[model samples]
Every structure is written in C-alpha cells, then in structure tokens.
Target chain A: MQDQLKLQRAALADFGLFAFRCDDVDELLHRATELVSEALDVPLVKVLEHWPDRGEMLIRAGVNWQPGVVGHETFGDDVRSPGGYALRCDEPVVSPDLDVENRFEMPEVLRRHGVRSMVNVVIAGEGPAYGVLEVDAQQPRGFTEDDVAFLRSYANLLAAAIERVRVHEELRRSAREQGILARELGHRVRNLLSLVRALASRTSAQGRTAEEFRTAFIDRLQALSTAESLVFESNRERTDPLVLAEEVLAPHRQEDAGSISIEGSSVDLSARQARMFGLALHELATNAAKYGALSVAGGKVSLGWDLEAQKGARKRLSMTWQESDGPEITPPQLKGFGTRLLEDVVARELNGEAKLAYRAQGLNYTLSFTVDG
Target chain B: MIDNKDGNLSGRRVLVVEDEHLIAMDVQDILEGWGCTVMGPVASAAAALELIEGDLPDAAVLDVNLNGGTSEPVAEALRNGKCPFLVMTAYNASHLFGALAGAPLLNKPVDETKLRQELSALLADTASDRCSGT
Candidate 1:
C-alpha cells in the first residue's frame, strides 16, 4: 500500500507537468482522466464538464468507458447524481456500494458496467466549479483518505489548466479583432483623405478671389471635420441625424436664436450619410445667410424630417429645408456650387432624390433617402 | 489643376463606380475636363450592372468596396461585356478576389496624371488588340 501511494504521487507529478504546458483543453482533460485511472487502478474514469447555459454536465472526456458512453452522455447538474452532489458540496463524495446505496440515484451506464463503487471530486477554478472528476471500480471498496487527497490534487491541476487555456484563447481572439479594427481604421483614414482632396478640388474658384476661395474651402472642411468628430465622439457605428444637424448648425444659430428650428424624431444615419448631410446643411445655411432667409432679421429656416416604413427592414427619410420671411427670391441665372452639390452629389450619394424650388417667398429644398435600420 | 496636354480622351465615355459622393464628383469633374463623356458615377454594384446592360461604356473605373459589399459582380459583368475597367480602392491588392484579381489597380486619392496615363494605355492596348484580331 505504501508503494502504491508512491506510484500515485509520481503519476500526479507527471500529470502536473503535462497539464500546465498543454494548450488544447481536450487533450488535457483526456490525459488527466487516463492518468488518474491508471494511478488509482480503476477501469472507468470520466470528466463531466459543467455547461451552465444547458444546465447539465456533459461527459467531455473519459477513459475505459463503454463505446458510446464517453462523449455522448449527459447528467443532471442537480444533487441527485453523485458527480453533481460532489460539485454542490465542494467536497469529495464516495459511494462504496451502489446496489444498496439509496443516497443517490445510480447512473444507468455505471450499472451497465457493473460499477459497485465510485469516488468523485469537484474540478474547481477560481471563478466557478468546472465540473466533477470521477473514478469507478468494479468491486465494492471504501475509498481511502489518501485516494481522496490524490483525486483532489489532480482536480485542482485540471481546473488551473482549463483556466489557462481559456485566458490564452481570449487573448488570441482579442488580438485578432484588434488587427481587423486597425486595418478598417486605416482604410477609413485613406478614404477620408481622398474625400478632403476631392472637396478641395471641387470647391470652385471660377469667379472668387483667393481669400474668398480660402474661406469657402475652410468652411466646407470645417463642416466635414465637425461631422467626422461627432461620429467619432459618439463612438457608435451609426449617428443620430438630429444631433448631427444641431451640431453643424450651432455656429449659424447664435446670431439668430429662434430663426433656425430643426424638428425631427430620432433616426440613425451611417457615418457617410451624416457627413454628407452635414455638408449640405452647411451649404444651405451659408446660402440662407448670403442670399435667402437667414440674411435678414425675422427671416426663418425650419428643417423638418419624417421617417416612413419601407419594405424589408428599410425606412425612407424625407427632410425639408424651408426658408421664409427674408427677401422676394429670384432664381440665380447660373447654378452655384451649393445648387449642384445638393441636386446631384448629395442625392446620388444617399441613393435618393433632392428638389430645390426657388419659390418667390424663400428657398424650399426637400430630399428623400433610404435608411437601413 | 489637371493638365490635359494631348486631349486624347476627347470623346471616350468612362463609367465611374464609387460610393463616396465627393470622390465620385471629383472623378467626374476630372474625366469631363479631359473631354471624356462620363457615364453614371453609380454608387452600387446593382446600379453599375444596370448601367452596363443599358449601354456599355468605353472603359470603367470601379471602387472595390461599395458600401457593405464588394464590387465583384460588377467586375464580372464588365469582363463578360469585354469592357476594360481599372480598380481604384483604399484597400490592398488581396481585397480583389476571383474575377477582380489581376485587373489594373490605382490606389485611392489617385493621381489624376497617372489615372489619365493608365486610361490612355488601356485604350491604346485595346485599340491594338482590335487591330491584331486576337
């Protein structure tokens, strides 16, 4: 018996070395059961993994079990089963005789294998119990205190190994996700650079002085920058259109407090949508201050939006920019940068349509675009 | 500030496929400045394909990523119609897969001079191919 205990200690040391270095959890669990079975001189051994979501313990790994019993078996997590009882009590449980034992229900597979006795210990980790480890013997015998001590040590090693593997996998996944996000951010940065280049080139210099050109270009860039920051500051994949409007129009709002009104329900817009819409709003406000409504006292600008349900998880957003009480407006002979941007560029970008009506009272602009919810 | 020295692309029709409005507008402006009659600067693969079916352009400029999906279908359609197209993208070469592989690639914020030169070369090559009848 002293020699047998020495052999068990050697097996435990051998398994401790293997478990710490092994990366695969499956191999670790299977090797543990095999080592314990050999050390204890038991024919049947298994590891039941606790699946909290399923509320059951799965036979994850085992040694010397029946052909179909190892991986294809499950047991209730409740205290009715021997393994469950050990897990609940946080102590080792020993059934010296199963046929005469009325404390726990006998498992069908153990009975089939003629299991007369078994010992189980909880495989516990720092967070929660991993599961239960059990060894079964064909002949009825009391499990010695030394046997329980060996099993407890083996279970503690298994739990530590399991946790190590889980943490390693989490680290690997987080690194991969960060790599993807970095690549995506790089792509977006390049795209934004391209957009700024486009805006600089498209900001026309047909009839304006260099200083005028600078102000116009800077204002447009400021609008784009404001939109980009709003999208980033929110840290959301999508941005709120009303908040976007409010932010973009804040500069124009101070001089005319009640002159500008934005009325819209909460709706989400893609980053791209918000930027373009913000630029359009800037142009509209600039035009209003220069020629249309916000130029004079008592001139009013109201931006209203409505959402209508469309087929297949899409919604249609219709926004109207109305200017009133300014000057008797006459349509300009030549289309300006703002006119072309609103009519063609903004409409095409949103996959929508925009109409500008140079009414005698004020400029009425309406645009409709699709939103993916 | 694009220099149109030769005026070679006097009447060539080039279809522009890009999702970003500013980029699309700039491309249109540049191509038109070169005297090319630019076709729809379509924002999606479906729209580009429909435009191709309607009237095949002389050549095409395709952005690899369109909104949430890739432009492989548009590339395939352009290939089937024997239409030459160059990819302008912010992504790397690996992003171009299957039908899009090995096509001419011009990185985003494309140099207007290089774009003009590449288009001229593509047209020159196609003109020679027609002459060779291969």
Candidate 2:
C-alpha cells in the first residue's frame, strides 16, 4: 500500500508538468512516450487510436518497438478480436496469460511479434471509443490490475495534449495564409487607383482649347501613369531609367513603325525619381503631338538624354525633345497652362528645372534634375 | 461678316471626322439643316485621309482620337491646305494640342451654339478672303 501511494504521487506530478508544458506537438509526444515507458517500466508502450473509416486500431506513438512494427501493424474491427473487445468494454483489460485465455483470441501476428502479456486501456470519451493504449511484456502474468489503472490515466492526458497541439498548428497555418492574401490585395488596389488617376488627368487635358497644350499634357500624363504602374508592380526600391522609359513609350509607337529612339547610357533612379521622370515624359509626348513632329504625317520625334556631374557634386539628368516634319510653328505670345504645369508644378514638385522652346519648325523641351543614389 | 440669323449654308461643304457612329450622324444632321453638304463621319484615320485626298472640304470638325490613335494627320492636312478646321475632343484643349498650342478646340459633349457660332465665323472669314483674292 505504501509503494502504491508513492507511485500514484509521482504519476500525478508528471501529469501536472505535461498539462502546463507548451512545447511543439512532435516534441511533446516524444516526451510523453518516454515518460510513460519509464513510469510503467513496461518493455513496450504505445498510444493507438480508432481509424473510423477503416475501423481499425492504428498506433500514433510508440516506445521500445521494433523499426516499422508500430506503424505497419493494425487490429481490424472484429468484435471477437482482442483490441476490439477492449474498445467495446470501454475499460482496462489485463491478460495475465494470453495462451490460456480462450475468449481473448490474441492474433498470431501479435505472438509472432513476441508479445506474452498485455494490458489494454480503452480511451473512452463523450462519443464512441477513440481506441486503446497498450503495454506489452515478454513474460506471462507480468501486468497487474494497478498497472492497468495507471496506464489508463496516462492515456487520458496524452489524448488531451494531442488535441490541443492539433488546434495550435491549424491556427498557425491559417494566419500565414491570411498575411499573404492581404499583401496581394493591397498591391492590386493601389494599381487600380493609379490607373483611374491617369484616366482623369488625360480627360482633363484633352479638353484644352489650345491644341499645343492639350497634346503635351495628355501624352505626359499617360507616360507618368505607365511608369507609376511599373514601379508599384515591381515592389522595388530602385528602377533603371532606360527600362522605365521603354515601358512608358511602348504604347505611343509611331504609326510608321519606327522604333522609339534612346540616347544615353543606363542610369539607375530611385523610385521617386522614376515616377517624376515618367510624368515629365508624358508632358513631352503631348507637346510633340500637338505642334511637334508627331502632329505631321510621317514625322518623327527623337529623344536624347545625357547625365552630367554638376559642380555641387550632384548628378543631373538632362533630356531633350526634338520634332521634325511638322507644321510651321510660331512662338506662343503667352505662357500657357501646360507650360506652367511642366515648368512650375512638375519641376517644383519633383525638384527639377525645365526649359521650353517654341521653334518655327517644332517644339523643344528640356528637363534637368538631380537623382538620389 | 455673316449674320447669325442667316439660315442658308448653300454651297458650303463640311467634313465630319468622328469615330462614334451616333455622334457623327448628329453632326451630319446639323450641317444638312444649315443647307451645307456633309461628306463623312469617317471612322478611322486612314479613311479620313482617303476622303480628304479625294475632295477638300470647305471646313472640317475632327475628333482628336479615331479608332486606336490620334487624328493629327487630318488636322495637319487641313492646316497645309489652308482649310479651316476645328478639333472636337473629349479631352480638354490644354491636354490635346500641347505643342501646336493655339488651335481652335471644342470639348465633348459639345455645346451646339458655340460650335455653330465658331463655324459661322470661320466660313465668313473664308468667304471674305476669297472675295479679296488673298
């Protein structure tokens, strides 16, 4: 009786530690299997659960079992079978001598695996029996009634822990999927808004009475929108100027099929600079279409750009817009809204300077700006 | 100067370069009511150019976008031939012709009265120029 009380206290203490511990499921299961094997001093200990569809007893965890024996072995749903009989009773069943117990009918497979005595505890719950936890030894009459009671209690704790860990793993997976979906949705929303803004700007510009300003402003807005979409879509901190320019100009290819002319070495621009340049190009294209070469049949617009190291130890980007074969143009008497928009609004907003020239043959516009490294 | 009250637009030939079929028909009806000959509600830039090459209209009302691209070529041809042309665009004038900054532009949905007044003025100028032989 004294030994029984000492064993009960030790089992309760181990149960308390298992209940409060918050380790991962695999680690927790491994520790539980080790503790049960040690506490019971059984040669083999295993936790098995019912496979409802297959109607069999399948091992979830095992200690001191031969390689591949735990996962591969199973007891089917025959009521006459030993495992099925234990599940039906919903109580611990000790077989002191399996060879003499005729009603027990232990399978030949179990005997081949060298099992002599066995204690099986049904994991009964609010619903149907879950399965059984079993301890096996080579010597007959090895398991007592006390061993059956101790194993049943241990099985209850393991079942609760498994359910808790399953819920935790599922929650983690759900949270990770939600985070990815949210980021993708945000990016798509931003792109759609940018597109709407570009459409609005173009519509407003095309309503201008002064044809020159109308063309210049519309083209510039289109270019800016294109570049803005590219940068936002890339999700990158920096972009190359040449690649950005190409994307902006792609939609405005000449009717004659002449490729857009590029004239500069590659320069890397910060995200802000790339957007600013996009807006500037839009303005240039609009102007070219209204009075420059783009306004005439078979006319060509040439884009030239170069980078200069300024005296202030800053790199300045210079771009020139030239048009040929367009209508004979005369200088405007007043600075129009487009001029103000590009030279004042855009330049001030982007920290750049612009020059506008209304030549007799076409229009020439230049923009110079510093870009951050 | 031609008086606004004058109903007749006899001997006047008008070119209509609009992409939308419904809008083109509306403009055609307006010109015909004024007793002018209406040439086309041309759908594409190529078609407009073809019509212009065949017969020069006394005046034209052009939409800035036709089919997929700009109607700048039609505008250019009219300017080269010294024919008076007005642009009709859904886009604002300041946005439509940035480089050739000072051309006459009309916004859509167009104000019929303004369009009539501008067309009358342009026709009157052309008639006077012909009389003066300049």
Candidate 3:
C-alpha cells in the first residue's frame, strides 16, 4: 500500500510538468493516458470524450489498446459501462469485477481482452464534464478510493490545457485582422494628402484674383471630398459608371429628375478610374448647371452609353452627353479648369480620347475607354 | 540661376510627361513663363517615348506613376537622347526606378522656384556629360 501511494505521487508530479510543456491538447491527452498506464501498472488506459448529441463516448486516446480501438471506436453511455456510470453520477466509478456485475454488462471487446476490473474518473471542463479517464486490469484487484481521487486531479489538468490552446488561437486570429485594417487606413491617408497638395497648387494658378481663386478652390475641394465619401462608403473597389453620374448631378436635379436622364449598360470602373471619372462627372454637371441645358428652365441634359466592342477578354465602352433647349452656346474664350479636366485628365485617366464641343445650340461631349470584362 | 546663353528660356524646347492634366498644365505654365517652348504634355510613358524619338527636347519633367505604373521606359528614352530630365513625383520612394539612381527628384505641387533651379542644374550636367563624351 505504501509503495502504491509513493508511485501515485510521482505520477501526479510528472504529469503536472508534462502539462506545462504540451503544445496542444491531442498531445496532452495521448501522453496522459500513457502516464496513467505506467503509474498504475495497468495494461489498458483510455480517455473517452462525451458526445451527448450522439449518445456515445468516443475513444480519443489510449494505450495498450488495439489500433482499431483508439480514435476509430465508440461505445454507448447506457447504464452498462463504467464510463456511463461515472458520467451519470458526475463522479468517479470503480468496478473491481465484471464477472458477477449485476448493474452493468461486460462489453465484448473488453471481455475479449480478458479485462475483469476498471476504474473511471470524470474530466471536468468549462461548463460540463468533458469525458472519463479509465484504467483496466486483466485480473480483479483492489482499487483504493485514493486511486480514484488521483485520477480525478489528472483529468482536471487535461481540461485546463485544452482551454489554454483554444484561447491562444483566438487571440492570434483577432490580432492579424487588426493589423490588416491599420495598413489599409495608412495607405488611404497618404494618397489623400498627395491629392490635396496637387489640387491646391493647380487651383491657385487658375485664379486671376484672390476671390476667383477661393471660389474655384473651394468648389473643386468640395466636389473631390463628396466623391471620396461616396466611394469609401460603398466599401467596394469598383463603382458603377451610371451611379456616378446620378450622384454628381444630385444637387442640380434636386426635385427635378426629369431635367436630367442617364442610360448605360452595366460597367464597373476600377478604383483609379472611378475617382477620376467621378471628378469628371462632377465638373460636367457643374458646367451644365451654370451655363448649359441644366441652367435654363426649358433645357435638359441626356447621357447615354453603349458597348462598342467585346474582344475576347477586353470590353470597350462609348459614352455621350448632350444638352437640348438651352440658350445659344459658344466656345469659351480659352481653356479653363473644366475644359482641361475634360479633355486632358479624363482622357488620360481612361487611356482614351474625349471630344468636347460648344455648338450654337448646346454642348456636345463624347468619350470612350476599354476595360477587362 | 544659370541664364540661357541666349538670355531667355525662349527657343529652348522642354518636353513634359505627366499623367495629371492640371499638374501638367502648371508645369507647362511655369516653363512657358520662363520663356521656354513647351513640347508634348504627353500623359503616358509610351507616348512620351514616341515624342522623344521624333524630336528630343533640351530638358524634360516626368511623374513617377504614369498611368498607375513607373515611367522607366520613357526615362530610358530620355537618357538615350542625351536629354536631361528630373522627376516630379508624389511617391517618395527609391524603387520608382531602381536603375535610374542618379537622376534628380522633385516633389509634387512643385515649388516653382526650385523646379527651375533643378532644371538648370540638370541641363548643365547633361551638357558637361556630352562635352566629356560619356
């Protein structure tokens, strides 16, 4: 009895150190069953996890058991097994004999292995009992109450280790997600700073007077800011060309949707293309409202597009804008910010050409660009 | 502040390669104000290269991201033409052109006075490089 007590003490100490070194739960459980087998001088030791939904306990890890018994085996939690009794009582169960056991029947596999005695301890976990840890012997023998107590402590250590690994994995996943979000924020801020710097210098040059400069700069900045808000809020890298036109013309068409018309096939513009075209549409709408069709009571603007061609992997889109019933129009004296933006920046951004004209009747515009379909 | 031997930037052709029109126009305005003749304000590297073959200018200004990519090909053409050029870019990085290491760099929203000074230095360097036969 004294020797058995000393052996059990050493087993608990060794397992306590083992738990600290285990990298994962599977390794912890497998090593634990091996430790139980060595410390108790038993032939069979197994850890079975509860699967209440399946109404069974599965052999998660074991020692001195057949290859088919570990991992690929399960047994019911009915009243016949020691594991079942432990779970039903939520405590340890000791069955020193199977030959004359009246309450539980001996399983064929255990009977085949000449097992006549068994002791099981419940493995306590977060919300419920995780499973049972059992030791088997071929001969019926005395199983002290102290031995059941020792097994219960070992099972507790296993549950704690599993929970530790799960929490670690969760933390690491959340940290990685935060890192990606921070990088995207930094990239956007840098781009915006560069954009404003370029805008200020160019807009100031367009101003002949300080007042003219303020008006042009403020209007341009407002347009860029609004477009940026719409693009980011959509949370999509590409924007629909038709939606862009409607949004840029929203203020002009307020309570007068009939004054402006938009028609186009479904086309998604790339991020760079979207920003450039969004700004272009803003300028066009602003011009029409100030001097073209949208300026007069009877004038109206119509925008339209068509798929010009689809060559294998590339698609070309052609668009047009015209004003009708506006007062007589004439070409501007010189190229201003609007004219330069339409004919130069917009054309360059789309890798296409833009034709802008001021006929006696109205302003006529045509543009075309190609994109991957 | 090196003066054009002719006492004016007039008659000295300046090639301009920039993707953004308004910014390009700013550069064109500055060059024209200095009395220099502005060549193509071409918006792409390919177009800039074509212009270089037709008539290489005395100097050029380039943007790093032309059509969303580096303008190294146009830089190469400018180098081969023995035409001095400086980059005015929004990007602050060395990888813009790893091979074009020694060329001058100017930042976006260019300080007009500094742009002219850098252009003079680049032009002078190109002239000396030719005189030395490198």
Best by TM-score: 1
The stretch of ten residues in a row with the least summed lDDT in candidate 3 chain A is: A198-207
> lDDT (0-100) at residue A313 of candidate 3?
69
Per-residue lDDT of model 3, residues A70-151, tens digit only: 8977879876776878888887778888776676777777887789899888887677778889899999967888888778
> Which tens-of-lDDT digit does each residue in B1-134 have in candidate 3?
34543234565678898876656776887898888788879888888877777678888888877666667887787777677788877555564665355678886667777887887777665554441212
Poorly placed runs, candidate 3 (over 4 Å): A1-144, A255-258, A264-270, A306-317, A370-373, B1-134
lDDT of every predicted structure (CA atoms):
0.87, 0.67, 0.77
Sum up the clashes in candidate 1: 0
Can you write out model 2's per-residue Cα lDDT over A1-373, one digit (the tens) per residue? Answer: 5675466558657765875575475566556667766676666777666787897877666787777766777877556667777887777778877877665677765677677788888765436666677777777865656666677777777667666666777898899999877865554344334333333433444445677546554565566566666666676656777788777766656455463476765766765567667766665666666656766677777777888886665677888877766777776666654565567545654567887787765677788787643
Per-residue lDDT of B1-134 in model 1, one digit per residue for the tens? 12224438877788899988779888998999989988888888998888778577878899988888778998887787777889999998988997899899998887898899888776665653431112
- What TM-score, over all chains together, does every model reach? 0.87, 0.40, 0.67
lDDT (10s digit) by residue, model 1, range A1-373: 9987998999889988998789899999999999998899998899999887887888999998878887789998888888778888889998888877776788787888889999999999767799999999999989999999999998988999999999998999999999999999999898998988898898889889999999999999998888898888886767888888998899889986799999998777888888889988999998999998888999999999999999987899999999999988888898877788888888988879999999977999999999886
lDDT of 2 at A291: 59
**Top-DockQ structure, candidate number:** 1
lDDT value, candidate 3, whole model = 0.77
